[model samples]
Structures are given as C-alpha cells and as structure tokens.
Target: MVMKVLFAGTPEVALPSLELLAGDREHFEVVSVLTRPDAPSGRGRRLMPSPVKEAALRLGLPVLESDPSDPSFPDVVKATGARYAAVVAYGRILRQPVLDALEGGWYNLHFSLLPQWRGAAPVQRSIWSGDTVTGATVFRLTKGMDEGPILSQSTVEIGPDENAGQLLDRLAQDGSRLLAASLEAVGEGRARLVPQSPGAYEVARKITGEDAHIRFDVPAFAADRQIRACTPEPGAWCLLHAEGGRDDTGLVLHVLRARPLPADDRAAPRDLPAGRLARTKRQVWVGTKSNPLELLEVKPAGKKAMKAADWARGARLADDAWCG
Candidate 1:
C-alpha cells in the first residue's frame, strides 16, 4: 500500500524534499504541508509565503500555516492521518503530540551529521570553524534537539571557498535525492541506525551582524574562511581608507569570490596591516595578519558587485592605511 506522508518544512532547503515526495504520488501521498505564516520581506516589506507553501499551492495540495506550538497544530496534522512525516528546515521544533500521530513517526533531513552542528546554522558553523568536511543526516526525531538516532547518513566534501549559501544550495540538491532514498529504505524495513561518534561535535550558533565584521588583522586564510562562511547573508567586509580622508571609516563590501595565496607567494608582506589593498592587472589582494587574499569579486556598499581590481582603479587604497 502507498504510504501517507505529511510534510512539514519552510524555506528553499525544504523544497527539494517536498518536490521529491510530491512527485511520487503512486508510492507516497502528500496529505498535508505545514509552513510558517506569511511574513514581511524585502525593501517593500510585502508579505511572502514560505517556499514550501508556494510549492504546495502549485501542486494543488492542502497547506497549513502556524507555529509548532499552536494548539491547533496537532489536530490539523492528525486530520491528514499520514503514516509518516518528513520535516526539513521546518524552522520550528516538533512537540510530542505531532510526533505521536504518525504511525511511522517523523524523520528529519539535517544538513550535518547527527550529534554535530545539531542546532540551527549547521552549514555556516561548519565552514566558519574550518572543518574540511560536512554532510547530510536522516534521523528519527526525538525531543532532544537534533540528538535523534540516525536512519542513514551521507558525506559531502567542503569546497575550498564555499560559503553557507553555496553549500546550502549544493546540499539541497543532494538532499533531494538522499531523503527519498532514505524514506524508501525505511518503508522496506531495510534501514539501519548508526550511533554518532562522540566529541567531534559542534553547534552552529545563529549568524549575527557582529559576525559579519571583517577583522583584517587576522590571518589571511582565516579571514578568507570567514568570508566564505558568511557570504550572501551577512557578507564579510572591513573598514578601509576612503578618499577625502573620512577618518578611515568602515567600507562594507560583499566578498563574491576569493582565493588563498600559495605557500611560495613571497610577494606578500610578513606583517601586512589589515585592510591594506594590493592590486595587479588581474586581481586585487587584501592584507590580513599573514599572506593576502586575492579578491576576485566584491560589492561596495550602495553599488553593484564588481571585480576587486576594478574597484581598486577608482579608489586608491594606501598601503599604510591599515584597519585600526
């Protein structure tokens, strides 16, 4: 018999899994979908529905909007009589009543391995912490955050300079397929549960405005890592000396792309000051505590993104102008 599936999710990260399940109408019936309530967004502050709601509407499926703690949530979910529920980036934790309704119980699609980066912001935290690897986890939900027992797991390599946004996009695509496979395994009663290893785990704290500030005095490689971790959300930037001598104010610029200096890149200064700009015909390099970052693209405040070298041409960045 086809399984009745209830999907709870919000945001683009959840769309792929929803789409995958929705597409398999013969094997899986998406009885209901739960998404966050419409909220104001963009410069105009227009109300916008969550991505999952948008997709559910496209498929002509039932959609509900409410917080997880709402009194009506369990009744609404129980109305569907779904055997299983798939939760991905739902933005709210599941309470016990909703958990007990599903015969097959609820499963989550988390971006990192279980017991690691369990809370929100896993991808961002992994990149910021300089981890060389991260992956996706499928687990049965319990009450203890992401501490659930895993049904399946897959490993993904962290690219050299990938930020949270880029990594999320990649994982979404991978998770689209992985989640479907996992659910299929569980349905066939062939899935195996694995216990996570102890002590290598870390939590991804939510990103804040303070985390976006670029500290030029830090090592170039470390600074680059920060840029990669926060990009496209809270962009990584620093204060530089602008023309007309405005007392060296903060010049926020979004880092679009960056590359690390090679071990033999002897041209950089040993004690190069933070926020100092170096340029060549092809690229613009910025000084950190050690080495330099070759900035391929940047977006200065109130301007479109441009090549760092192009920005350097109009703005003369003095070598002595270091970040204070």
Candidate 2:
C-alpha cells in the first residue's frame, strides 16, 4: 500500500529528502515534484534549474514550476492524485486553498525545531545567535509560518566551530531520514501531532547585506558568530586601511575563517580601538571590544581566498595599521 506523495522543494538542501522519497518504492511513490521556476544564477546570470528539479528529472519524475498566485496552481496539484505533500525549503508559502486540495494535507520539513526559528533562514539564524543545539522538524502545513502541529523531529548538536553551510549539509542528511519515517507513519495512520506550547518565540528572518559586516564593537564571541553565520554567502567583510595613505579609501576583504583570541592569549593593549589591526610573525589579529580575533583565512575583493597572513604580507600592513 504505497502512498502517493507530491514533493515540493528547491535548493541543494532539499535534494536528499526528495531522493529518499523517490527511492522508497515500497512505501511511497513520488508522483510529481513542485519547485520554483528556473532563474538566473551566478555571475553570468544564466537561467538554471533548481537543485530539486535536476534531481527529480534524474529520477524520471514530472516537475511543476509555479507560484502560489497562479490561478491554476490548485488545479495542478489536485490533478496529481497525490494525497500527501512533503515540502522542504520550497521557497514559497502555500495558500489554504492549495493545502485543502491535497487529500491528506501538506507536511513541511523545517530545518529548526518548531516554535524556534520559525521563519526563513533558520540554519543561519541559529548559528548567528550562538545556539549550541538545533534540529529538524516535520509538521503539518498551515497558513501560519511554521506554526503547525509537529509530526516528527530529530535533534543535532551544533559544533562550536561549525558554519551555517556545514551545519546545513549535515542537517539535510539527518532530516531526510526523519522525513522518511514520518511519511511511513502517516501512511499507516499512526503519526502523532503535537501542538506547540505557548512561550516566547524567535523568528529567523532572512539575512541581508547589512548583516554581513563584521562589527568589532561587540564581544569576540559575538563577532566570531557573525563571521560564521555569513560564511560562503553574503560573506562577512571588512574594510582594510592601508599605511602611508596609499589607499585612504580602504579595501574590502571577505573574512573566510577566524577565531576569537582568548583573553590570556591577547597581546595588544586593552584600550586599543576596535577595528584596529595587529600582527605577529605568522598571524593577523583584529581588535574587538572584548578581545582580538585571529583571521585565519580571507579573500581580497578580486582575488581567491588565501591565508590571512599572506594577505597581510601582500598589503605590507604596518604594526600599527587599523581596519574598519
């Protein structure tokens, strides 16, 4: 008794769950995959199929690309004869009508635990806020954002040095296993639904360019979290001040990897202004309010990423040079 499932998702994170459903032929049949339309990507802006679309095509599944605003969207879903819809990072919110069209309703696999990080950018927001533990949740779909009753969840520990990209990759794999089990329970009419408790809720808003700037006025740990959160996308960047007024305008450099120097290891004067730069024989440090951060890797505006020490040598920064 294989249940027919309508899969909806986009992006690389969604591929694992999509593939898992497609491979579970005994218990589930992926009738069709719904994803966002092809859009321009990369520097050349060439139209590209989403990661889910590519995977769905490779599995010999039909794909539908449409927004919720389309008048015929509900009809398209109804025609699939899919009783259950499993969504992950679908990149679009579903209207009530669309959810009603499905015979068994919709289920969404969110990257964060329910009632926390309930909006977009959950993985990035969790790391940005320095949370030590985060996990995935599969819940029934409703009009409210991630407010539906929980169907299944699995927790994962966040590594102290993990960035959003790495954490997401790991969670995606864990979530696929959880999603498969939940789908099986649903098909057998044995899944439990738990309502979220009343309490303070945090929203995981989308990240913007403004959030990518490294703020040295905060504690070293805070700055480190910001850099980790923005790594690999909308990268954390800082302006470098050149000595001798060679470039008073400053140069933009992306911070790829960094660590906050412990108080005992900090050698600079405590009163040094934030955003100042200092260097040892083999390492480069940036002053913050509480301590300095050791820049391990960086990428100049037009160059590939390299060791921060290498960039420091190329710029010939004086011992007293500063960056903002």
Query: Could you say which candidate leads in TM-score?
Result: 2
Clashes of each: 0, 0
Per-residue CA lDDT of candidate 1, range 1-324, in tens?
A: 577888889898898899989999767888989888888999999999988899999998899886678777777778887888888999887888878867798989999867889888899888988888889999989887887788887889998868889899888889877888888788888888775666656677788868877767787788877888888777777666654254656566677778778757776444445666666666677777777777888888889899878887876766454432
Q: How well does candidate 2 match the true structure in TM-score terms?
A: 0.95
lDDT of each: 0.80, 0.89
Clashing pairs in 2: none
TM-score of each: 0.92, 0.95
**Candidate 1: 10-residue stretch with minimal lDDT:** 315-324
Cand. 1 TM to true fold: 0.92
C-alpha lDDT of residue 24 in model 1: 91
What lDDT would candidate 1 get against the real structure? 0.80
Off by over 4 Å in 2: 244-247, 266-271
Q: Which is the leading candidate under lDDT? A: 2
Candidate 2 residue-wise lDDT at 173: 97
